[model samples]
Target: MEWTLWFSYILLSFVVITLVHSLLLPNLSKIRRIEGVPLVSVLVPMRNEVRNVKGMVDSVKKQTYKHIEVFFLDDESTDGTSSALELAVRGDARFKVLQGKPKPEKWIGKVFACHQLSEAAKGDYLLFLDADVRIQPEAVERALGLMQQKNISLLSGFSRFILPTWLNKLLVPLQHFFVLFHLPILLANWTKWPPATAAHGGFMFFERSAYQAIGGHAVVKENIVEDVAISKRMKAEGYRMWIANITSVASCRMYETNAEVWQGFTKNIFNGIGRSIPLAVGIILFYGVVYVGSGILALAALLVEERVLLLPYLLIILQAGIVYLNTREPLALAFLLPVASVAFILLLVSAMRKSVKGQQVEWKGRYYG
Candidate 1:
C-alpha cells in the first residue's frame, strides 16, 4: 500500500511537471511581412463541407499574405460541397477548385485528396488545412515566418476549439491536454526521435520540397492518424518538424454536438495509440487508477474515517488542476476530470473492439476499414 501510494505520487508529480512545462512553452510569435512573398498553396480537401467552405474561403481571402493560391479539392461530395467551393472562389483567380477523382484502393479519402492537391499545387510552400478551420489574417504569414526562423521543414499547429456544447467543452480540451501533458512539445521540437514527434492534422504547413521528399500524404495514404504518422516519418527521415500552439491564429469547430464528438473520437482513438493493445490497456488502467480510482478512494476515505488514503486523491486533484491551468480550461471543470478520463478509456476500448471485430469506421459519408 505504501509503495502504491509512492508510485501514485510520483506519477502525479510527473503529470504536473509536464503540464506546467507545456504552459511555459513559448507561443509562436506573430509575423510581419518580409520582402518577396513566396507563393503558398493553401490546400483544403473537402468532402461534404458545404457548411464550412464559404467561411474557410472568406478567411483565406482575408490573409495578410497575398502571394497564396487556394486549392479546394471537392472529394466527390454528394452534398453541395463542390458548388460551395465554386461559389466561394467564383471571381478569384488565386483560387482553383479541383474535381477529386475516386480514391485508389487501400487509400484513405482525405489522404488521397491531399495527395492529389499536392500534385496540382504550384507553390514553394504548402499549407494544408481542414475545411472547419478558420484562420486569422496573419496566420499563414506567421506560420511561414516561424518555419523559416526555426529552420523547420514541417510545422503543425493546434487550433483553438470553439466549444459551444457541454460535451464539446468537456472533451475538446482533452485534445490539447493529451498532446501537452503526454507529449512535451518542447522536448519533441528539440529531439530527432520519432516517438517525440507530434502534429495536428487541422493545420500543417510544410515546405514543398520537404513534403515531396517525404512523399507527402502518399506515404501515409492509408493511415487514419495521418498527421502523426507523417510527422513520425519526417522525423525518421531526419527532417525538422515543429509543433506549436496556434490558438491565436486559428480555430476549429470540430464537432457540433456530443454524438459527433463521440463518433469522431471513437473512430480515431485506437489508431491514435498505434493500435497496440498493451499501450491502450495501459493507458486505460492508468487513467482509471489515477483519475477515477483517486476520486472513489477519496470518497470512501471520507466515509470510513481514513485520512491517509485521501492523500493520493489530493495529489490527483493537484495534477488535474495543473492540467486545467495549462489547457486554460475552467477550474470547475477539473472536478469532472475523472469522468472525462473514464470516457476516454471507454472510447479507446470501443475503438479497439470495433477494430478487432472488423467494423468499418465511417466519416464524411465514407467508410474506412
Candidate 2:
C-alpha cells in the first residue's frame, strides 16, 4: 500500500518534469509576414488519397508563402488521386502532379516517392507534408522563421489530430503524450545527437543543403518509420534537428475508422522503437502498472474505502491534462485519459503480437515487415 503511494509520487514527479520540458518545446514563431523568402518546395506523396487531393491542393493555393512549388507524387494510387489532383490544380503552374515510378526492392513506397520528389525539387528548402494534413496560411512563414532563427537543418512534429470519432480522439492524441513524456527536448533540438531524435513525416521541413548532404530519403529508404530514421541521419551528419509544437499550424485526419487506427499504430509502433522485444516488454509492464493499474487500484480503493489508491489515477489525469494543454488538443479529452490509456495498452499488445509473428504489416495497400 505504501509502495503504491510512493509510485504515485514518482508519477507526480514525472508529470512535473514533463510539464517543465513541454514549456521548452519550440512553438512555431508568430511570424505573420515575411518578404523575399527563398523558394520553398512543398512535396506531398499520395497513395489512394483521392478524398484528400482537392483539400490538399486548396490549402496549398491558400498559403501565404506564394514563392513555392508544390509536387503531388502519385505513388500508383488507383483511387483516381492523379486525376483528382490534375483537376484540382488546373491552370496552376506552381502545382505539379508527378506519376511516381515503381518502388524498387528493399525500398518503402513512401520513401521511394519522397526520393523522387527530392530529385525533382529545386528549392532552397524542402517541406514534406502528408496528403491528409491541413496547414494554416501562415504555417510555412512561421515554420521558416523558426528554422532560420534556430539555424535548424530539419524540423518536424506530429500534427494535431482532427478527431471525428471516439477511437480517433483516444488514440491520435497519444502521439503527443509520447513526444512530451519520452523525448528529451534539449538534446533533440539543441544538439546533433543521433539517438536523441524524433520526427513526424506529417510535417517535415528540411534545408536543401542539409537534406542533400544526408542523401535525402535514400539514406533511410528501407525504414518504415522513415521520419525518425531520416532525422537520426541528419543528426548523425552533425545537423541540428528541431521538433516543434505544430498543432497551432497543422492538423491531420490520419485514419478514417477504428480499424485503421488500430492497424496504423500496429504497423509502426514496433518498428518505431527498433523492434526490440525487451523494450516492448518494458513498455507493457510500465503501462500495466503506471496507467492501467491506476484505474484498477482506484476501483479497489472504492470497495476497500482506501482513498490513497486513487492518487496515481488522479495524477495520471493531471498528466494527461497538462499534455493536452501543451499540445493544443481538446482539454475535455483529459477526463477520458484512463480509458484512452487502456485502449493504448491494448493497441500496444496488438502491435507486439504482430511483430513477434514476423507478419507483414499492410498499410496503404502495401505490405511491410
Candidate 3:
C-alpha cells in the first residue's frame, strides 16, 4: 500500500478502536442497582483542600446508600484543612476526622494517608474518594451495582472533568481520549494482566477483602503514580479490575489554575507511561502526524479544491466527535481536537525534559522523584 493508504488505515483503526473501547467501559447510569447492602467506607485523604471540604462533605452526606462511614485523614496540611474538615462534617456522626501519622520513609504522602484510613476503616467495601471529587447521591449505590453486575473486585472510574478554562478543556479531556483510544478496554476489565491496567486516583472503589489480599497501598508504596500502580498490582495478584464511565454521576475539577495543571500533569504524564522515553517519543510523533497533520492537510486541500485531500481531517474530527460524546462536551468541540492534540504533545515534551534531567516533581508542597 502507498503512504496515503497506510495512513488512512491507521487512522481508521483508531476510530474503530475508540468505538469498541467506549462500548466496553461500563456506564454507571445504565447499570441496575445491586441487591447487596454491604457497608462502604468513604476514605478521603486531604492536604490543603479547604476549598473542597464543604463540597466533599455535602456529596457523601447526601448519598442514598445509608450504610457508609466517611473517614477524612488530614495529611499534615498547613492551610487549616483539619479544622475545615472538622467543621464541614461537624453535625454528621457518620464522618470521622483522623489526623494522619507522620509518613514513613519511601511512602508517597497520599498513599500513606490512604493506608492510615484503611487501617481505621470498618467496612466491607472501601471507596477511596479524593477530597476534590463531588459525586451524585446515587453514585455510591450505582458503583456497587456495577461491581456486583460485573463481578469485579476493584472498580475505578474517571469522573467527568470540570474544565473551567480553555486550556483546561484542551488538556484534561485527553485523559478520556488516551484511555478510550489506546487501552483495550476488554483486556483491562476482564484479564488479569498487570500491564493492561489503567485507573484514576480521584475515585477508586475496592472490595476490602481483595484490597487486603493484594497488600493495598503498601504494594505500591514507592510508586509515583499510585493509582495505576495499585491497579496493576491487583491484576498481578489475579484479581479483576474494571474502569468505569462515571461521568453521569460524578464530576471533579482537579486543577484550578494553569500552573497547577502544568505541574500535576508534568508530575504524572511521563511516569504514567512507565517512564519509557520511546513511548513518549512515539506518542508525540503519533499526534504530530495523525492529529496535527490533519489540520495542515485540510488547509492545503482547501487551497487546491481537492475533496479527496479532506478525508483524513474529516475522519480525525469524526474520531474526536465519538470521544466528546461521552465526555459531555459540545459536539462542535471535536473540531478543536487538533489544538488539544498540540497542547498534549507540548505537555508531554515538557514532562519528558524534566524527567530526563532527574528533576523532582512537586505536588501539594512535597517533592518526589
Instruction: Judge candidate 1 against the unseen true structure and give its global Cα lDDT, from 0 to 1.
Output: 0.83
Local accuracy of candidate 3 as per-residue lDDT tens digits, 59-170 = 9999988999999999999999999999988888899999999889999999999999999999999999898899999999999988887778999978888887778878
- What are the models' TM-scores? 0.92, 0.97, 0.96
Error of 3 at 365 (Å): 0.6
Sort by lDDT, top down from the best: 2, 3, 1
What C-alpha root-mean-square deviation, in Å, does candidate 2 show against the real structure? 1.4
Tens-digit lDDT track of model 2 for 127-192 = 999999999888888998888877889999988888888899998998999889888898888888
Error of 2 at 44 (Å): 0.2
Could you tell me how far off, in angstroms, the CA of residue 16 lies in candidate 3 after the best superposition? 1.6
lDDT of 1 by residue, 57-168 (tens): 9999999888999999999999899987888799999999999999999998899999999999999999999999999998988888887777788989678778877777
Runs off by more than 4 Å, candidate 3: 1-6, 31-33
